[model samples]
Target: MSAYDVARHFADSWGLVFLFGVFLFAVGRALRPSARDEYEHARTVVLRDEEPGK
Candidate 1:
Protein backbone atom coordinates (compact mmCIF):
# COMPACT_ATOMS: atom_id res chain seq x y z
CA MET A 1 0.00 0.00 0.00
CA SER A 2 2.74 2.44 0.99
CA ALA A 3 6.52 2.63 0.46
CA TYR A 4 7.10 1.38 3.98
CA ASP A 5 4.82 -1.59 3.48
CA VAL A 6 6.46 -2.49 0.17
CA ALA A 7 9.90 -2.20 1.65
CA ARG A 8 8.91 -4.24 4.69
CA HIS A 9 7.50 -6.98 2.52
CA PHE A 10 10.65 -7.19 0.46
CA ALA A 11 12.83 -7.18 3.56
CA ASP A 12 10.78 -9.94 5.21
CA SER A 13 10.43 -12.23 2.24
CA TRP A 14 12.33 -11.92 -1.06
CA GLY A 15 15.09 -9.70 0.29
CA LEU A 16 16.67 -12.41 2.37
CA VAL A 17 16.65 -14.83 -0.52
CA PHE A 18 18.03 -12.16 -2.85
CA LEU A 19 20.87 -11.30 -0.48
CA PHE A 20 21.70 -14.96 0.10
CA GLY A 21 21.71 -15.58 -3.62
CA VAL A 22 24.09 -12.68 -4.09
CA PHE A 23 26.32 -13.98 -1.31
CA LEU A 24 26.43 -17.43 -2.83
CA PHE A 25 27.15 -16.02 -6.26
CA ALA A 26 30.01 -13.92 -4.94
CA VAL A 27 31.50 -16.90 -3.11
CA GLY A 28 31.14 -19.11 -6.14
CA ARG A 29 32.73 -16.50 -8.37
CA ALA A 30 35.64 -16.04 -5.99
CA LEU A 31 36.25 -19.77 -5.61
CA ARG A 32 36.01 -20.62 -9.29
CA PRO A 33 39.48 -21.44 -10.61
CA SER A 34 39.32 -19.26 -13.69
CA ALA A 35 38.61 -16.18 -11.55
CA ARG A 36 41.92 -16.39 -9.70
CA ASP A 37 43.99 -14.46 -12.19
CA GLU A 38 41.22 -11.91 -12.67
CA TYR A 39 40.88 -11.21 -8.97
CA GLU A 40 44.62 -11.10 -8.53
CA HIS A 41 44.92 -8.61 -11.32
CA ALA A 42 42.14 -6.60 -9.70
CA ARG A 43 44.12 -6.48 -6.47
CA THR A 44 47.32 -5.31 -8.11
CA VAL A 45 46.00 -3.12 -10.88
CA VAL A 46 44.81 -0.50 -8.38
CA LEU A 47 48.28 -0.26 -6.91
CA ARG A 48 49.81 -0.05 -10.34
CA ASP A 49 47.40 2.69 -11.34
CA GLU A 50 47.92 4.83 -8.25
CA GLU A 51 50.64 7.45 -8.04
CA PRO A 52 52.76 8.73 -5.16
CA GLY A 53 50.00 10.64 -3.39
CA LYS A 54 46.22 10.40 -2.99
Candidate 2:
Protein backbone atom coordinates (compact mmCIF):
# COMPACT_ATOMS: atom_id res chain seq x y z
CA MET A 1 0.00 0.00 0.00
CA SER A 2 1.05 3.56 -0.64
CA ALA A 3 1.94 5.89 2.26
CA TYR A 4 -1.28 7.84 1.95
CA ASP A 5 -3.43 4.70 1.97
CA VAL A 6 -1.71 3.29 5.05
CA ALA A 7 -1.98 6.58 6.88
CA ARG A 8 -5.64 6.87 6.05
CA HIS A 9 -6.36 3.34 7.31
CA PHE A 10 -4.64 4.01 10.62
CA ALA A 11 -6.51 7.24 11.07
CA ASP A 12 -9.83 5.56 10.31
CA SER A 13 -9.28 2.88 12.96
CA TRP A 14 -6.69 3.42 15.71
CA GLY A 15 -7.04 7.18 15.67
CA LEU A 16 -10.70 6.85 16.59
CA VAL A 17 -9.91 4.46 19.44
CA PHE A 18 -7.17 6.75 20.76
CA LEU A 19 -9.48 9.77 20.77
CA PHE A 20 -12.26 7.81 22.47
CA GLY A 21 -9.91 6.64 25.19
CA VAL A 22 -8.85 10.21 25.85
CA PHE A 23 -12.48 11.29 26.07
CA LEU A 24 -13.25 8.57 28.58
CA PHE A 25 -10.23 9.46 30.67
CA ALA A 26 -11.31 13.07 30.88
CA VAL A 27 -14.89 12.16 31.78
CA GLY A 28 -13.78 9.71 34.43
CA ARG A 29 -11.50 12.26 36.03
CA ALA A 30 -14.21 14.88 36.13
CA LEU A 31 -16.81 12.55 37.66
CA ARG A 32 -14.61 10.83 40.17
CA PRO A 33 -15.98 11.21 43.73
CA SER A 34 -12.81 12.63 45.23
CA ALA A 35 -13.15 15.71 43.05
CA ARG A 36 -16.58 16.67 44.36
CA ASP A 37 -15.26 19.07 46.98
CA GLU A 38 -13.07 20.86 44.48
CA TYR A 39 -15.92 21.21 42.01
CA GLU A 40 -18.28 22.49 44.73
CA HIS A 41 -15.73 25.05 45.81
CA ALA A 42 -15.43 26.31 42.27
CA ARG A 43 -19.21 26.43 41.84
CA THR A 44 -19.71 28.69 44.86
CA VAL A 45 -16.52 30.71 44.65
CA VAL A 46 -18.05 33.32 42.37
CA LEU A 47 -20.54 34.37 45.06
CA ARG A 48 -17.95 34.76 47.75
CA ASP A 49 -16.36 38.12 48.43
CA GLU A 50 -12.96 36.70 49.34
CA GLU A 51 -10.75 35.40 46.56
CA PRO A 52 -10.49 31.67 46.11
CA GLY A 53 -7.66 29.84 47.88
CA LYS A 54 -7.52 32.58 50.51
Best by TM-score: 2
Measured by TM-score, how close is model 1 to the native structure?
0.60
Worst 10 residues of 1 by lDDT: 45-54
Candidate 2 Cα errors over 4 Å, as ranges: 51-54
Clashing pairs in 1: none
Per-candidate local distance difference test: 0.91, 0.95
TM-score of the candidate numbered 2? 0.70
Give the distance in Å from residue 11's predicted Cα in candidate 2 to where it truly belongs: 0.9
Give lDDT: candidate 1, residue 22.
100
